[model samples]
Target: MAEQMGSCKYLFMSLLMLFQVVQCRVLTVSEIVDVKLPHQPKSFRIDLVHRDSLISPLSPGNISSTARWKRVLERSNERLRKFQLDSRSYSDKVSDIKDAQAPVSSGTGEFLMKLAIGTPAVSYSVILDTGSDLTWTQCKPCEDCYSQPTPIFDPSKSSSYSTVPCSSSLCAALPQPGCSKSSCQYYYTYGDSSSTSGILSYETFTLTAQKLPQIAFGCGENNQGTGFSQGGGLIGFGRGPLSFISQIGPSVGNKFSYCLVSTSDPPSKTSPLIIGSAAGLNAKTFGFTPLIKNSVHETFYYLSLEGISVGNKALDIPAGTFELDSGGSGGIIIDSGTTITYLKQSGYDAVKQGLDSAVSLPQADGSSVGFDLCYTSAAAAFPSITFHFKGADYVLAKENYLYHDSTGVVCLAMMPSSDLSIFGNFQQQNFQILYDLDSSTLSFAPAVCDSL
Candidate 1:
């Protein structure tokens, strides 16, 4: 779970950066040519180190007796009631695939991770993204390029930098509005509104011991988002050949897995992303759930939920009404692009009543949540809510699991709609979430997300 959250933080930050640099111009290389991969084989390797320990078991000493963990389970029935209609808009479309099953929890585990990339220049701290598919970075001739913390990947400096001719087969697949000729040019737009422009290029790339045969990326002539300060480039996770994982996937392991840590957590103990066979889940030791492919968005996974229950009482929500996207958070956005999560008034009332029983509250506005439970003053006991799905229960920790702008502040991160519920990262902490594209299933396990 920690690892997944770490990846989510990267994605979220990328979105935020994208929103800030929406209308930047891209510089183009003078040479117009066909796009093709390098013919030589380049190799590299990476060393990884595990930085976190397993979470201790929940026990009497670890929890407060006065307020039982289960007692804190509350349903914002009223909030959910009002948002039901909106929730439907964000709800995931059910899949017809036989293996398409709802998300389930197994056991806790961890993995070793190493990310490497070959750029036109000596690129440092280039960001890797599992949620996107195009790999790109700021380059020379960036007349209006914004300043950033990391150095740009200059193709001209690299001994191996080579252009992908316009006629190459790889250039045909660039996700552009008019991808007709081989005049390889790419324009990418991220959810947060970050945009980059550059001509396409084919290069021999290396990640650890693995070397991808042919890879294409958007070499931005100019870029604008510099807040991240870590990398001037983005490695996309989409299905194109330029995407980071897909290019090396068949070689790295057969799949990749990530759990992003919440931004709210301290950065020192930040979680690391994992890929390939190094992923800690031992199939032989842990349970396996069928992967369900999404019919509508071929890139996403779909699961049929049985229900969600808080202790003995099951909230009255339709099964198969929610969808989880591992790439998104801040809150669960069951968005198909348009609708938002709508928690009905009844659901919000039920949830709030339960939460209010254990924690005090401050007034609220649409923008922020103030708190009654002060983390600095005293520790507050919280309830344990089980997100029941397909007969399995995924447990959530109190601190990282439920979050507010401030402690005890009553605000609408989870807004009231009508009847539907949308779960995001606020509810995703301490849970090992696995998005398996090969099997088409979103899996979860109990975890100590403090590190992620």
Candidate 2:
């Protein structure tokens, strides 16, 4: 049986799917809707923990740089700890304030949307995530508890949702070797505490206008925890088919991408995550860099670093160091688990210095948040900070670097002086990032950000 062959004893079959080779072609922004993405098998999780010790291209070598990087990360750690304390200490105040500013739409929790899986119409709410992958949700039983913000997907109600036979070739290719059971039991754990477990099924899942004819996915029977609080389930962006975009592949579009605009920004102006092909990037203007082979899962996209720069001034550091992860949050999440952006010592220092020179904010006691600038007051225009990817310079927008917190406090710099540089969502949103699994190249171009 396919399931038995894909189990622990069938390591070869798993390897074939995980490392299958294919010739890759670059897709232009306009081609996003034109190309069909290949249906490649995705993986479960990274085996190793992402530690600060890992080299970042920007961080490179230089004892002072390393120390400074650590110092900044330490400060960030302290600030985050304090932020958590502040959150708990001023919980009531913050909560009340949030309630007053919260839009009527915000309180309703999940947003309901119809999803079609391989020609079958199934109703489900996809919890939009800027920070995760592996989209999944409740299905079948529809019976018990777990109050969801939107309606759950009923397989019987869907003409297309069907279970993958235990012996199917595709079913046996699940990354988690032994997990290819007849009943379809699979589990996934994220860098965050969020996780999901469910049975595999094939169906036609649809987005607003995007449609995947026959996509494979996990139809969770028991969806629980704070992770599922927002809606029916998650619509992950990570390199896994568990995500709607990943499952749809070349059939719907040749590639997948999204642009995350700020929530504070106007509704009409939204970030788009384009799958198959991106919309604004000029393929001719874009440069390419070798993507790191899955140091973890075959599905993840990674890049080896040489170094980074601010303008013409390049940070003196080692080459062939650092890795790029799209899954990071904030501006650049240097670490695997930490949610905030972790900048390299030089990058953080330069950015912070620029901010400090431009604006100022005061602590409760009037002592400035101690940065070159603080977000407590209205912001003044700051200098542009360009992240040097390989030899290309990718510029960041003003909004991409600054954010007003829940208290209307603007954070001039997203990362604390001490965190490792992680090109997080803040920086990522400005460019059209392409992860070519076949060629193992990470390519992007500046849309709002300076050209790369």
Candidate 3:
């Protein structure tokens, strides 16, 4: 039900409460080095793969931008509706919702990155999900698996592969575990009824030639699903213990940043995901904002959305419309996978009403038929829209965050949500966003992602 862009099927993360066990390595280990990249000595770049990219076999031909936006809004609402039905509760229930909503590839999610795992280092196109933690892939001896275009990872062939013993600390952290005789078994089920079960093992995760030793991930042996067949696996960047970031945060200074390009951009070249010591961006350019930690699930990067200003005027929206609660149900989250922004009803009304009043022209696109895009003959004459984050005043330029359709329509790439609000990827195009775990801060600056 949670979709970056969204797919036909709803994905659910199986993290049932565990009854535990016996063999694996401890958490801390030897220092790992960054891979040698041609540029940016300490930094490496990973290309951002768009959804249904023309270069990708799963993608159809380029559809109209108008059609794509329509689909995005529709998908956003559909997921939110499911979320409403699920009805976020206390911590445990909220975690279930997050798992239920996690992205599993297909046509609806955001960008995909080519990541490598194991000794021979097999490259896998994994969907990047900031909301998720466990990085997993369909592995060899796969009794059950999806029909992936790429080869399944064979750990037996990789020299660095090792099974995480049922007794390791990571096993304790596993949200839901199925007990087995020798090793830790993981059985995950998506909301759509798709499921994957496998062993928790240690593998060398390669990012840009860097052989990160002792990285723990799920070796999915029996996976039955209809979603995310295009890629080999999923990459979790959440704050949980098993996430790639949490595992590597110590060596990389607890900082990572990505400048997202438009999914409509050319597939050959797009944005880059930067990590390690290289993530110390210029503070003056990319101003900092204190990130709110979720009491329920610490994995999400929450931010307090104070208010919004249209034409340099702060709208008189209801107070506390964008509050970040410890429960994690309501709040604004900056997500990498979601394509469009979603504002809760109160915030939406204030912003929409302001924009409607400021713009002097009629909607050029189809709104009567249910669309969020708007148009104006004097689009330039329209005032600017600003988002007030805690301790920051982030600004959005027209072309940077808005889409100017072929029909000369200036559309707002955001809409209203009945449940939680999200600041999506479309609003993040060409901007560098840094998540510093150690400092508990999130920062952003305008960037030409294609050039970077």
Candidate 4:
């Protein structure tokens, strides 16, 4: 069983970032094409290291007797609350393909990137979130900031640092709306009550041997709530115009892909996040799904989920449940920050029955676990679930579809949604998922993530 609250700190901060998407407006390069900048490397690699991989096995002295179970229940509650909040947020149809809340344990096992910011090159560990678009870090001279492991970055020491003026086109894209000051300022709040406010600026960003000049980033001087973690800040890789991909669009060719290790696997394993044209070679693995863009929320990446098949039979759910409608109806969203998958009610029920029929294990009560479809059986055979996308069928193994709780109960990892359905990162484990904005298509191919 996975430890829960241990990672809640990262979860809540990521939650705050995603929530800001709903309130902020993105002003992208299209609006500021005339702004000339410096040259950047055509392609390079950023080594990703998962913090969990560094942890030692929990000894008896490390955890209290009941603390483990309590953590599982608490984390489960966080997942339910997040699912409900995101369903409502997406249903509200804030005019995007969309926004979502992640499971609390997500950050505990998520991949982190080591980034070098400023001309002097101050380094910090940051979470890489495909679900969000803005890249920010806690800066020095803060009015109010959360505690971070690294010394807060002081932009004044960096020779290349320059604040974006309110008159600049990038400032107009900010969610802050009216700008009275010369510096472009942003105030972002999350559904969980955390907020970040700071000045927008461009800085030199370095990852290993590659150095990217004139990268736009938020230099947060005033941050509240889950503002920072051991992973000092977050790097958003969303489809938005202001996202990492968008900012590096010219160099990367708008293509990137990652293969997440199975959450059930030990954190000792790390994965690759191939950027630029190199990700294009992953297409040879097959199982290509056409990607869709939401007109309203340009940052979100959307995919059509045709149906889910249990074994050889498809569930008795309606196809329209996964369809993206302009009326803000139900649709499927793919997000990496989320640790579990969520299905609409009818679809969820059908899958549940299939599990109940296929596995002979007695159904364990899930009240304390915060979900349904759990059992006490060990090494039981679980019906493999295949998510039929637009043109590809991505099948999941027993390890990917089942959850082992703290109390020796194995439960279906997926949750039931009232309206919105999300393809969380958990299901994408060991799959090389390619996001290509150039062709507007996402592809997937199974691979041993550790080998990647």
Task: Highest TM-score: give the candidate number.
Answer: 3
Which residue pairs of candidate 4 clash? 27-173, 96-297, 240-299
Candidate 1 per-residue C-alpha lDDT over 404-440 given as tens digits, one digit per residue, 9 for 90 to 100: 4333332323445433344544454445555444554
lDDT tens digits, residue span 1-452, model 3: 45653443322221211211111222233321443325423545677767556766455578776666665655455444433332365454446545655443222356778888887888878878786677899999989787876899999999999888888888777767765886888866544345667999998888887777898898999877555475788888888888888987876678898988766567776678888777766446667899888766666677888899987889997888888555557788887767778889888888778888887567665573245657755346767788999888888866545666656667776778876888888788878899999999999988777776
lDDT of each: 0.43, 0.45, 0.72, 0.70
Residue 102, model 4: Cα distance from true site in angstroms: 14
What's the ranking of the predictions by lDDT, best on top? Answer: 3, 4, 2, 1
Candidate 2 C-alpha lDDT tens digits along 1-452: 87876585668766666565422345577687545445432211101111111222122233432243333434345323322222222344345434432111110111122343434454554444322344567776843325665566777777777776666654565544224545566554321223355677777765654555556676777653343444556554445445454555445333544334332432234344444433324556886666544433433344444544443456554332344335331122212222235455556565565555444445221112322334556455555656665556566666656544444455544554332244555455556666554454566765642222
Question: Mind giving the per-residue lDDT tens digits that candidate 4 earns over 1-452?
Answer: 15576578679988988989864756576755533344545565555654444442211133532343344334334533443343354435243213434323222225577889988898888878776667888888989987876788898899989987788766676655334367788765543445577988889888765777888778888876542443677787877766777888766677888888765565456677888777754445678888877765555577888888898888888758888677544677787765678788888898888778777778888666566788888577777888889898989998887767766787787888777677877688888888888888898888876776
Judging by TM-score, tell me the better candidate of 1 and 3. 3
The number of residue pairs in model 2 that clash at the backbone is 49
Q: Model 3 — TM-score against the truth?
A: 0.82
lDDT, residue 287, candidate 3? 73
For residue 51, give model 2's deviation from the true position in Å.
30
Q: Count the backbone clashes (under 3 Å) in each candidate.
A: 86, 49, 13, 3
